[model samples]
Target: MFDSSKRQIGFAPPSIDNECIAAVERVLRSGWITSGPELKAFENDLETYLKSPRVLCFSSWTTACELALRWFGVGPGDDVLIPAMTYAATANIVLHCGARPVMVDIDPIERVVTLEKLQAAWTPQTKAVMPVDLGGWPVDYKAIGNWLNSAPIRERFQATSAVQETFGRPLFISDAAHSFGAHIENMPVGTQADITGFSFHAVKNLTTAEGGALSFSLPSSLDLEQTTAWFRSMSLHGQSKSALEKTQSGTWQYDVVEAGYKCNMTDIQAAIGRSQLRNYPDHLNRRKEIAAQYTKALETVPWCTLPVLKDATRESAYHLFSIRINRFQSAQRDALMARLKEDGIATNVHFIPLPLLSLHRNRGEHMRHYPESEACFNEQLSLPIHLHLDDEDVTWIVERLCYHVGELMTPHA
Candidate 1:
């Protein structure tokens, strides 16, 4: 049933309420806007949300990841395993750190890296592995942790940083841009990995317009305060004093202890994030509710294979509601999306596997070895699942989708 009213259905969009607007306004009127109190409070709020020791906000998740790798001493001649079924940023950070990214395949069902695949991809040079939490569905860290605990793998780890020396194993970094506010087996995502990076991109479940944050979970043997300070310095051009600290009366002295990247979050962005965090529980719940609505309507559609929403072991943030049409090829998938566009609906694909991208392909990453990733790319489609979508919007999107799917699935007579 095509929309008769010319109603337009968009993909995910940010929810900017009046409260979010006022938050930005407050920051603007504060005079001192850059890296001020708002950003500090937002980091504190994120620290509380993740229940992790340290939370450092950044300009983007990409920088947050690169900085983490750098802090852990991942550099030239090292290898970092990244999931093939994810946005390039997951692997790109490894490249930016001057480490070779070993693109690995994922489990077909979960659309995320698994222990078996990781084991097969591991090499003596492997320094770390960044597991991605695709579409907000939490990765099974318990299984992954078991894989890391083995003596054989642990012995291969080369400790570079003071903190890495404590772990005695390759770092497990979670590229959890989609999984913020997500939990696995009752534990939050930030607690599941050695380091976790979250996205607050404009299109994410929670937006700071364009910002991200990192959470730390070092072994108890390491000093949390010392390590947190080190990361803060690394994000601010390795300066001894932050802009906020330097502003204090008669305290303008600072030094560039080491070369570092500039990736600090802005106060304006933090203000929006702070507002979003204030009602995060409700925001997260609304996303879950919308996911339930989609699942109930599309469950019986044979061609549609819904993404992993939640189970006993994990609860997703529901950032994206991606579906795999069981019988559709890439050509058919494109045609269905085109049909929906004609009906005033906008749809999109979650990702094109890294091996399929030119950067990785030129680096000798071949798609032939990643059959599961290729299969996912050919059939997957992301439907609208933001809080902005009302019941009518969702109902219409599903109806239009089913109609297009039927037309494509039916044998040409």
Candidate 2:
């Protein structure tokens, strides 16, 4: 019988304390609370943390990245290569731009798209390569950058806009929504890609309540200040000056440059993010400790395949602890999730690859086309890893997980 008095472990809950509450309260008490000083301070903190040249905050990762695609002129007749194993938002943004998202298969173990897979999917219509850092593990940014800049890849370039022409090759925009603190080649994830977008969603490792930011790493030839201004304008309906700027005594007059999207991060949200950022290092360390605990406890299990936390060149953000049960089918995986839930433990899947979604299926994308992604999705299960969980919670969760998995894997009569 399941114990009703036991605590139910959540999948990923935001770590909010008095600091976060006080920060939000301070913002609420301030006279100016929109996109203003707080947001700028938060962006500066991120810029320093990631050691990137520039960073822009937005309402959500979806908005920030979609804006990036638009900036690159990824319109109809263009193809953006992405992995089939990522969330629907990855593909949805491409479709929203009226471009096609050419899905690529992932390495079953790494669960990330490789440069070789991307090379195979390239075409003249390929305008951008937006590979995701699945589960906060970075893709091979160095190799992919080299491949994209190679003579063969560059010679086949098709520039549709001034920004595209300036690059003389396809843009390497990384969907780094899960890799905010992750690193590769002694550099942060944001510095590797031409433009990397990080999610600060409530369920993410860091929460802005609901926000995101983009880190830019374009070539030296472009005017980065102008580029930054343009993105800031676009986020605020293309106004020549921000509402904060317009508040000045005689600076009310401003012009709209172009029709743009309204997705700027609010000062209130930035306050929460700033508070979180202050103690983010400790939060991240705690997550890593929990992941280590889970790995050490479960590695001895015969059927369990633990996730890769670190390698020679890359390290994850410890966003999720996804384990693969060898030979587990989708139905069995679902059953195991249910069994864990019955014990008041919440387990989840990282994603149901784009091919399995109805939106992609209607476009003629088949699950059979991505065998590796299909296999990974079937066996993959994301275990809870959050600040809310302590060592005792991790041990209990692991015990329940192994018990339920063992029961489900037993031979049936």
Candidate 3:
């Protein structure tokens, strides 16, 4: 137990320390800040960490993934399969590309979209599929991949651009924003998808404050060097030469190849990410411990349905400790959260299903269509699981949760 006045446990706060500050200070003193050597080095480090062939950093996941949509030519009249349970960015990016986000319902237990749902939703106009790893639990990537490569499905794919025509199949882009360090079959999440985008927002496990990265494992038909250059150039207004390249003597002149978006990661951000990556494995371990503590304490509770952290083939990154209060509707769940807040503890819901949002609703998407997503949303409660917490804090949170839930479920005056 904690003194309410003295304890204020924030939900998913950034775990910045003296070392992280020092790294930023060094970058600040370096004089060159934007998209320079530090960014390149960070990408290389991420490549090694993720076991990816190559990785690229950008301002955020939305931009990096939207660029992928643009690069793959996902425009109007095309359909991109996505889960209704994901964050807005997943569907918003599809809409930004002038394509329809064919939202699919999640599996009741997995809380992630399945190959069957995607297959059922597929159409000749479906140009791509962007599945999210909701709450760090990866969707069935192998099953989805096998489906994409099946001869019957491949024959139905309609290629509207050169990039699409090359593979003769719909693109598989993973919305791995919350699953950066998660694994499937002992392999990291990045290599499984054709292109996997990772978010490094302040709350993420391996944050760059406000940054994201993409790891590519595109089909061999595409030229890696050329594709890498395309993304790099696009991130910087489609310029023929980078600021670093033009710094060479008598290399000032350059050409603008195409109108592009400006969403490059700066050196300062990279410095923070580099510092964090050095001890990421240890950070991951501590997070796992915290998750285990919660699971061990609550697994026996009749009303609690603990989130899956590991199984035979997949392991979560432990980004969020989202547990379900069985049979609790939105009102009771919110009341439990209120009780936790009164104790100076913070909690959150991972997301409101896409269909429930005004933007998606106006677009003709309805919450009723995604029964599993709505049901999951009603009971989902994401407990604080950050490095800022120690064993005692976790135990305290569990105690408060148990008490509040019991009170809510009990009949009282």
- Per-candidate TM-scores read 0.97, 0.98, 0.98
State model 2's lDDT: 0.92
Q: Write the per-residue lDDT of candidate 1 for residues 1-413, one digit (tens) a residue.
A: 64456787778777888999998998999987888789889999998888888888999999988888888889999999888889989888888888998888878899988888898989878888888899998887888877886798888777777757787888888899999889876777897788888999998988998999989887787788888788888889999899999989999999997898899899999999999999889989988888899999999887788999888889998988999998578899999889988987788897989988888888888999999988998999999887777788889889888988887888897
Model 1 misplaced regions, further than 4 Å: 1-4
Candidate 1 local accuracy as lDDT?
0.87
TM-score quality measure for candidate 3? 0.98
For each of the candidates, the C-alpha root-mean-square deviation to the true structure, in angstroms, is 1.6, 1.5, 1.0
Q: Which pairs of residues collide in model 3?
A: none
Question: RMSD in Å for candidate 2, one decimal?
Answer: 1.5
Compared with the true structure, what per-residue lDDT tens digits does model 2 show for residues 350-393?
89999999999999999998999999999999999999887888
